[model samples]
Target: MDKKLIGAIMAFSLAGSLLFSGCSSKNQNTGEQTAEESMIQDVESEVTLGEYKGLPVTVEKLPDVTDDEVTDAVMAAVENASVTGEITDRAVASGDTVNVDYTGYMDGEEIPESSVEDYNILIGSGVFFNGAESSLIGVMPGETANISVTYPEGYPQEDLVGKNAVYQVTVNYIVSEEQAELTDEFVSQISDCQTVDEYRQMVREALETSRENEREQNRRNAVWDKVLENAQVVAYNSGEVQEIVDQYTSYDQSAARDFEMSLEDYVQTYQGVTMDEYTAAIEDIAKQEIKERLVIDAIAQAENINGDNATDEEIQKCSQQQGYDAVDAYKQDRGSDGMAEDVKGLRVVDFVVDSAQITEE
Candidate 1:
């Protein structure tokens, strides 16, 4: 599955933001019903669930972490913990990060906009103009050289595009990285473990735990996929679908605001789609999400695990699982209805998974 589609599915699966409209009160005179109850009732009325229990699913068997993988993981941790220091003994070389002061000139006239002082650039990184950083290679600190660079076509500055410019660059000290030795001292500094062997065992155990978690997640996904495949939606509730679409749109609008771009521009730039295309895609995703929610609700209703009647103890347990200090805080963040619906959906998933006949491949 596409990562973006997976993210969208995960976002919708939470049930926190999903709200349905156009549902009648269960009690006409009292007219007091939670939104979650109305939503579940609306979904149950709209969707017809297929066989969910005892569904057959096949998932890949978990693989054991190999010695080579453990070694690689240890090396990666050490590499990430490397410390950088100045290398004044060597001249600038390829892949070296060096500091420099430079002024650019076009047609023998200085370009004020291109001049920079004490700028740090990685050699061959192309941070400076074409061939500018490359020219610094073999130049020692305190040395000055005139390097010519040609700006490529379609450069941000149209006037400088395809034009040659001379830069009088003075080389500064190069930055070098030092990797920590794998010894008891280093191990004690990095972790509670005081020996290299102990650190290796710790890393191996962590990797095994991570792999096991991945395998479990894959199994759960397989079960959910089978359940979704077996389910059927009789008809989509337009009000609910529109509500989900609105939520999706609002999320995109917020993302656009974060990027400081207009919605149309953001969609076009990041999604590579016109507003119409994006809207259509969002609608399709919303409909699929609604179908999934409807199926989950249908299962919850059939199994007598409806969220509307969730006990206070259940809510408190859920709040603790969500890492909230108190139920009140959790309820304030996720509305009471949303919290209950999330708990209900989780319970339904657990039930379906337990009932599933799973085979490891």
Candidate 2:
């Protein structure tokens, strides 16, 4: 299934936001409060959509779940698929597993904390720099060998970058891997199924359900795209766009914190974009998102579709289920009106999907 369409549907249909961690300020002027409050309180009445109806859309054909696909899916769930082989006397070779004691040295001095006993390394795994794994090839058990290699420039460790290092390596033992066979016992261990045939059937049914879901999402995506293409935006509020921009900014700052770098450094180093460039790009994304919301709102109004019918009791129960002690706290974090907006958008999308003329290929 296409992740973009799945993400779009989830974003519009859900009430929570990953980017925006803060809620809009409460409006004081509007004494006559309405049920449908736009996300941005100040710009609630500033942006409006003109019309949305009878949009042309074509849905693609649903993907088929082949026998090979079902087999692959079932095999992926098999427990203890690989087993270590009996100890072998064969020389260290590619694909062979070995245990060894190693000590690394740099500039003729043993590096502190660079020695390990009974360490495991898979031959030809490319887990180390040049010649580290290849140097162990053809070495017999209990044999000691020396491997010398230079760390490449721009290595993750600042001090070790471009440094020549030597390792005193010893081969402990070699072992091969044996794959587990497919049997009733294996099926019972991995899944609820008791037999291989039963497991295969279960995989087929699961694949069918997944395919149907993807087809439904594709239909919704087609409907939404066509609706957006035909919809007209009579006016747009800059404040609304800025609200979304703030979300992007907050998310970026959070990500930068995770990377142990300032937002500016993170953007320049990882993204190759300056803060100004990122802000401009984020503004465009925010505007596009706002436009989609406006279109969904217009369609909801046109079709007389409303999903914000949850009672106060229902809201309280939902809040409790979400681990909030009080409904007010839940409303504050998720926005009191966000649920209504999500419900309305979902209803509008449902109408679009139900009414769309799907042309399958």
Model 2 per-residue lDDT tens digits across residues 1-361: 1122223322332222211111111112233422332333444533354333455666678668999999888777654476555464678888877888998899889988879898778888888675487789999988999999888777667799878899999888886676767889777877789989998999899999989967876766666666655555444476877776676567667768999999899778766777776665555555556667766666666678665686776555445434466778767765657656545566666677676667878
Could you tell me every candidate's TM-score relative to the true structure? 0.58, 0.55
User: Residue pairs in steric clash, candidate 2?
Assistant: none
TM-score of 2: 0.55
Q: Which runs in model 1 stand beyond 4 Å of their true positions?
A: 1-45, 83-177, 258-260, 306-332
Tens-place lDDT digits, model 1, residues 1-361: 2233233432432222222210111111133533322343344336767789998898889779999999998888787786656777778889988878888888889986888887888899886765568988899988988998888876888878878889899886787778877888777888999899999999999999999967766766778767766766666666776776777677768878999999899878877778876666665555556766787788887889766777787677556545567778777777867777767876777788899899998
lDDT of 1 at 166: 90
